[model samples]
Target chain A: MMKRIGTYLLQSKYAISVTVLIFVVLGASLATSSFLTGDNLITVLRQTSVLFILSSGLTAVVLTGGIDLSINNSAALVGCIVAQLLLLGVSIPVVILAGILVGVVIGIFNGLLVGILKLPPFVATYGTNMVVLGISTIVMQGKVIYDLPRNFTPIGVGYVGILPIPVIIAIVLTGVLYFVLQKTTLGRNIYMLGSNAYAAKYSASRSVLDTVVAYVICGVTAAIGGIVLTARLNAADANMGNSYGLQIVAAVVMGGTSLLGGEGGIFGTVIGALVLTIIMNVINVIGVSSYLQSMAVGIVIILMVWLDIFTRSKREKLSRV
Target chain B: MTTKSLGKRIGSLPPAVWMIAVMLVFYGANTKNYFTASNFISILIQAAPLFVVACGQTIIVLMQGTDLSLGASLNMMTVVWVVLMQKSLPLSVALPLAMGTSVLAGYLNGLIVAKMKLPPFIATLGMQNILNSVALVASNGSSVYHEHAIYKIIAKSSFLGVPYILWITIGCFFLTMVLLKFTRFGARVISMGGNPESLKVAGYSPDLATIQAFTYTGFMTAVAGFLLACRVESGNPIVGNGFEFNSVAAVLLGGTSMREGRGGVGGTVFGVLLIQILKNGLVMMNVSSIYQTAIIGIVVLFAIMLDAYIKRRQEE
Candidate 1:
């Protein structure tokens, strides 16, 4: 019975993440009773909502066997642009639309570079990131744009019966993504392309177009994340989204998504984001030095990646046996 | 016949060389005294440390791997060196200790990639974060100043019309060139990049070559960091910020293939010169720093695309 349970655990896609989540939750509860309180738990989920949106997009790109290092930069640029537009008296909806459109255009450009020009994803997205940073700096002139209209606050801070708007958005998006990934032909093509591009080629998949679309989804979601963040803070700066680049990558990797592509689901990413959020919250509650936070995060990322690799190899061996 | 051959040779030269020449002429036309010997010497001085760093970066890139920890390693080395110097440790002890730390950092990176089998990108990225934090913690997030005469002398002293820093930079490049061209390890390094499977079949360890490449990179980064600290006479935690990307950009601009095994230190010299000239030219043209970055980004994208196009055409 124990062996059978072990095999079941190994076969289940969500098993490892669930185990990790349970461990972190229990540990955090032990560290501080405040961690399990409803208010703090909601706060953690609210903070994780923005990262969830960003990671959802990244998961699509990663599922296609490509990465978009520029997602954070794209988000920052869009946020800055949207903030500027709002300050100029543009309506909030129009401003939001403009921001997302900007992200889509950048995504299309990245798609062209990766799909059509055949540039490596790292180099192409890195170049795009630099360009976006430069442009954002020029737009803001290295100053933060604040004093946003209050109407913009609802998407970030508003609550419907004690549930934050951002959390609701994250949940709805995850459900939509789950549906698309499981039930759509394009989604299946993305998985196939990531798993084996050579085989995908002969199977009538429009590989390049699919790759482009995946990046577009990544860009749009990043832009939405940016918009939400701007609303949360009621401000935007050139460097605002810089930290998100590495953080989002870490969360996605921790979520059981393979950097080499062809495997992973959005649900795993959600758990990954939650785990990271809880870790940070615990660190904060425990009064760890801010300087050491980065070190802690880095160590956690390495450990999680090692654990992932170990489990994957074990699972493969078991399957072969 | 000689003239035609010479024209062909010039035409075949990397795009960076022509870009440098064109920028020089443009700067000369736009800025006063841009062509003076003093200004030229200053440009060379600024390029020296960057050239050294790029030389190291070139080797790692030839192996189809990257060392993103370079900038953080530089920052950490500067912080450690400066802090030790401030504590009244003799320069002799402090300098070697700092360099040894860098070597250890490089070895850790190599172990993670070579032994643990992590992708170089993720491994180096994590290392970058760790080293960055170490630098911050060491320096307490503030700049450490060294007002000693030795620091000034090392930065400003000249030997036969060349600065001491310039000499050190050239020496580093020369040593690396020789290592790449005249050593068995060098051959193995190149082969490891070009064909790892074959290297394994031949009974030589690619893992050792990877470790050696990273170790060499660490040494050069330490030397460059030392030179930078000397020039400024201060160690700021952010001193090496953006340098890793800049070095990668310089190496790529030098016509190195990102795929590995197809570039050399020779082209990297011209690449370094090209970037320095562009920076100086933009400043002389009164362009803002932000716009300069945008322009450089555009140029990088264009160069990489053009390289890809050329390779594709050749294949066709």
Candidate 2:
């Protein structure tokens, strides 16, 4: 029975991540009085919601064997612009539309650059990220905008029947993504291309289209995540999304999605985000230097990727045998 | 015949070289006595450390790998050096230790990227974060100022009408050029990027080449960080900001392809100079620093695309 359970966990890469999550939850609960409390849990979940939102789109890009480093920076740029408009007394709904529009534009730019022009994803995204960052700083002129309008905070911090609104948005977004990845033609195309691009080309005619759509999804989700995060903090800063640069990616990879693209799902990413949130929450509660937070994240990313590679090699060996 | 050949040589120069020529004329026209030794010295001072860093950066880009941790690890090295000096450690001990720390960080990156087959950006991104945090933690979240006589002298010293820093930058550029041009390791490094199968068939391990390239980059960036700290006489954790991406841009702008080892340090020198001059001229002309980054970004993208287009046409 025990061996059977081990086999079950190994079959789906989610087992290791779930096991790590459990251990972290248990350890955090044991060590800190401030952790494991209902209020603290809710707050942590609220933060994880942003990861969920961004990772949903990123998972698609990663599944297609590409990455979108500009997502967070582009979103932050849009957020800064949107905040300026809001300060001018722009209506909330229009502000949201404007944000999404900017996201789609950036998304299309990334898609065309990476997919059509055949520039390496790193060069394209890194270039776009720098441009976004430069524009962001110029837009804000290096000043932080505090005090977002009161009603605008709902999608981020508002509670719907004792559950945070961000969590609801995350759940809805993840559900849509999960459905699209598992059940839809576009989803299969992404997995096919990611697993093997040359072979995918012979079989799937719309591979390029699928790749563009994946990046667009990534961009749009990043935009929404930025908007929500800004509302939650009630401020907009160009560097607000700086920390999110790799954490969303970390979550996606940790959740069992291979960084090499293909072979992962949105549901696993949820657990991955949860694990990171708990780890970060515990670090905060323990109050070890806040700077160490980045150190911890860096360690997590390296460890998770190594683990992924190790398990993949093992699985391949087993198949050969 | 000699004159005709010389004209052909000038015509064969990369677009970046021509762009630099145009900028020089513009700056020389606007800024009085721009070609004077004093003005040249000022530009060299600003370009010195960045050129040294780009010298190392050129190697990795040739291999189609990137060290995103270049700036952050350099920050860590400077921070480590300053903090150790502040604690009354002798320069002999502090200097080696700080340089060693940078090497160790790069070694770790090399291991992860080459052995584990992790993406260069991902592995280096992780290292970048860790090194940045280490700098912050070591310096206790504040800049450290530790002045030494050596730093002061280096900043002021000059030989033959050029600053010592510029001389050092030139030394680093040639050292890198020699390493990339005349060495078996250099040949293997380029081959590993463009045609790894060839290297493997020739019984060479591509992984070893990758590690060596990364370690060299780490060592060079450490040297750069030391030079920069000497000029400023302090260490700030955020001091190396924007360097990581800028180096990549410089390498690409130098007519280097993203892969296939199509360009080398010969072109990277001109690339680095172009960027530094553009930046220096903008500052000299009083362009707002805010607009400068955007302009740099646009220029970087446009140049890279143009290079790509030219390469594609050549291939056809």
In model 2, how large is the Cα lDDT of residue B239?
85
Worst 10 contiguous positions by lDDT, candidate 1 chain A: A197-206
Alpha carbon deviation, residue A288, candidate 2 (Å):
0.7
The best candidate in terms of lDDT: 2
Query: What tens-digit string does per-residue lDDT give for candidate 2 at A126-210?
Result: 8898888889999999899998888997777799999899999998999899899989988888887789854725543366678
In Å, residue A18's CA in model 2 sits off its true spot by 1.9
Full-model lDDT, candidate 1 = 0.83
lDDT of 1 at B287: 90
lDDT of 2 at A35: 87
Where model 1 places Cα greater than 4 Å from the true spot, the runs are A1-10, A197-205, B1-12
Cα lDDT of model 2 by residue, B154-178, tens digit: 6778789666787888888889988
Residue A293 error, candidate 1, Å: 2.2
What is each model's TM-score for chain A?
0.94, 0.95
TM-score of chain B of each: 0.94, 0.93
| DockQ (Cα-based) for each candidate | 0.62, 0.65
